[model samples]
Target: MTGVPKILMTLGAIIFVVGFLMQFIHIGRLPGDIIVKKGNTTVYFPIVTSILVSIILSAIFYFLGKFR
Candidate 1:
């Protein structure tokens, strides 16, 4: 029970840091991401960034679990 709050706080801090970095880093503009721009409309998707983030987070969790 006590560990739940600590985990939530850690996750929140990680999310806050990522949000802060996204403002300065064009993470959504990485190559392989989809960007459609029409005369008056624009759509964007960060596929590559999402994959990279997934892999990184998976590795982090895997290692942490191993250590535990």
Candidate 2:
């Protein structure tokens, strides 16, 4: 129980920091991301951004598990 709370708090803090940093870091508009504009409708897909985020998260989890 105690561990769960600590984990949640840590996760929340990480999320808050990421959100705060995102204000200055444009994350969704990577070069490889798809964007389509047809007349007035625009469709956007952050494929590259998703992959980047996944890689970063995987590395973070790998390091955390390694340390644990």
Candidate 3:
């Protein structure tokens, strides 16, 4: 019923927030590429990672809802 959809929305929001936070809890930059130490080394790609994850999750939710 209506209650079920509300619960789904709430749960989806929580899942999204938790996933988003995972990218920031690290010791380095919030996401993006970063240079470490005095040497020349750059770690990249995580900045777009969070968005990609969120999009994938949302797509999954959307497809699942198509049957409901």
C-alpha lDDT score of every prediction, in listed order: 0.91, 0.96, 0.71
Better of 2 and 3 by lDDT: 2
Global local distance difference test of model 2: 0.96
Cα lDDT for residue 3, model 1? 96
Error of 3 at 51 (Å): 28
Model 1 lDDT at residue 45 = 90
RMSD of 1: 1.6
Ranking by lDDT: 2, 1, 3
Best by lDDT: 2
Clashing pairs in 2: none
Provide backbone clash counts, one per model: 0, 0, 0
Better of 1 and 3 by lDDT: 1
- Model 3: lDDT to the true structure: 0.71
Per-residue lDDT tens digits for candidate 2, residues 1-68, read 66999989999999999999999999988999999999999999999999999999999999999999
TM-score computed on alpha carbons, candidate 1:
0.79
